[model samples]
Target: MRGSVRKILLVFSFVLILLGFWFSTTNAYTFIKGYMLFQTDQTHIVNSAEEPSKQHKDNLKQKKLYTIRPNKGENIGNLLIPKLNATLPIFHGTDEEELENGVGHFDKSVLPGEKDNSVLSGHRDTVFRKLGEVGKGDTLIVETSAGSFTYKIRHVRIVDKDDRTVIVPKPRATLTLSTCYPFDFIGASPERYILVADLISQKLT
Candidate 1:
């Protein structure tokens, strides 16, 4: 009888140990599966959050790539000076021929309304005869194939004829108009009259 009782007790203890091992194994697998699922959800959330920003950058790149750039000497647009009640044709190049026709866009600079500086030059005797009348707080409107951009004159500068600051890059869209200083001078002027304007509004075509 004593031997039989001892065997039974040993067998019962073995069964309990096996049950504990199975429970522990099942718990570990459940924990690992839950952790993997949580990580997958987090990865999906991150991708979703980044998609729109990536798409916006791609769209901007496409627009920049496909933009139409005018050829040198092309008729690109017109400039309207409300203060002077005048409208002037704008050509792509600043050569003598372009200046004779109307406002001449410096070929080295960006187009009007684009970010950075857009330089327009004309003879003091002709196209810009009355530019001196337009001063700060005045408006200059540029109508182009891309849009109509309105700029408000922020500064009027009289710099040396050879000054290169008139064509320097700007932090935002800017319009720089240049003409010989001393609008009434008899011969070639020694200085340049400059109107620096900041873009105030735009109407895309």
Candidate 2:
């Protein structure tokens, strides 16, 4: 009876050990599976966040580069004013000679159709003699080697001739036209007649 009891005790101990081993193995498998699933989900989230950024960079790289750079005093384009039914030549520099020939483009500003302020200036007595008749809601079109850009007038102002705000940077594509104020002023005018326009459309050439 003592031997039988001892044998039963030994069998019970072995069964307990087997149960413990099985439980531990099962828990280890569950933990490993959970960890792998967590890692996969993290990887997926990271990839989702990075994909748009990568695509944005690729799109920026694929955009067309504006390569129309004209020398100072060179004819670069034409400015068409629909209200006045006029088309004027646009030159690169705002010098006296260029202004005498046609409208003068401020070299410091961006070119027409670009993503910044493009400024054009003309004499009150010549190319822009009737510019006073043009007000807000008028359309201005610029045709350059790069493309033809249409802009709609948004604001009209008469600022002092020395005001630097006329050439300030714009948030988007803009066109600024300036001429001596009082269109009938005998000589050098004291103020500038300004027309600010926003780009409406563009046709690539």
Candidate 3:
């Protein structure tokens, strides 16, 4: 009976070890994939008008071509937060797969450099890990194939996770960056950290 009990205990220990290894492996894979996706170039965009193709071709002659027709899950642009010294790829959607790769643009919101709220989100523990270090008067820059826009941080606030007021349309062009609150939390965060900025300038490349 003693020997049988010893064998069962050993098996249980081995199973626990395997579970831990699997967990680590999965998380590592996710992080590595996300890193690679962010480093890759994104030259695509959804064209709402005929100017897209013509614009892209024209830019191509200048060796500045951008704005290819985008499919789902394509890279859109890059988001730079000077205060945090962080630059992350911005994808088209806020879904899990897209967010896993980098910061994600809310598709329902206006595009960057446009005349409405352009909302971007990321995981607090990853891309926006240093977000808390940012403050008012800082700058946020978004670079896309169409152009680069500079925003001046006007406000920073912590809101409930479900708050929709933060993303409401504004009379002036704006940029909104969001992430889960309590950056060091172990599980699903219950609050959101919001960074609101206004478009101060833009340069069409």
Best by TM-score: 1
lDDT of 1 by residue, 54-94 (tens): 99888776133118788878899899999989999999899
Q: Which candidate, 1 or 2, would have the higher TM-score against the true structure?
A: 1
Candidate 3 lDDT over 50-123, as tens digits, reads 56878888876533324454455789889988777788999998999999999999888878887779899999
Per-residue alpha-carbon lDDT of candidate 2 for residues 1-205, written as tens digits (9 for 90 to 100): 9999999999999999999999999999999999999999999999999999999999876235266588999999899999989999999999999999999999999999888899999998899999999999999999988889999999999999999999999998999999998887887799999999999999987
Local error of candidate 1 at residue 117 (angstroms) = 0.5
Ranking 2 against 3 by lDDT, winner: 2
Question: What is the lDDT of every predicted structure here?
Answer: 0.92, 0.94, 0.86
TM-score of 2: 0.84
Counting clashing residue pairs in each candidate, in order, gives 0, 0, 0
Clashes of 2: 0
CA displacement after TM-score superposition, residue 150 of candidate 3 (Å)? 0.2
Clashing pairs in 3: none
Task: Provide the lowest-lDDT 10-residue window in model 1.
Answer: 59-68
Can you give the TM-score per candidate against the true fold? 0.89, 0.84, 0.65
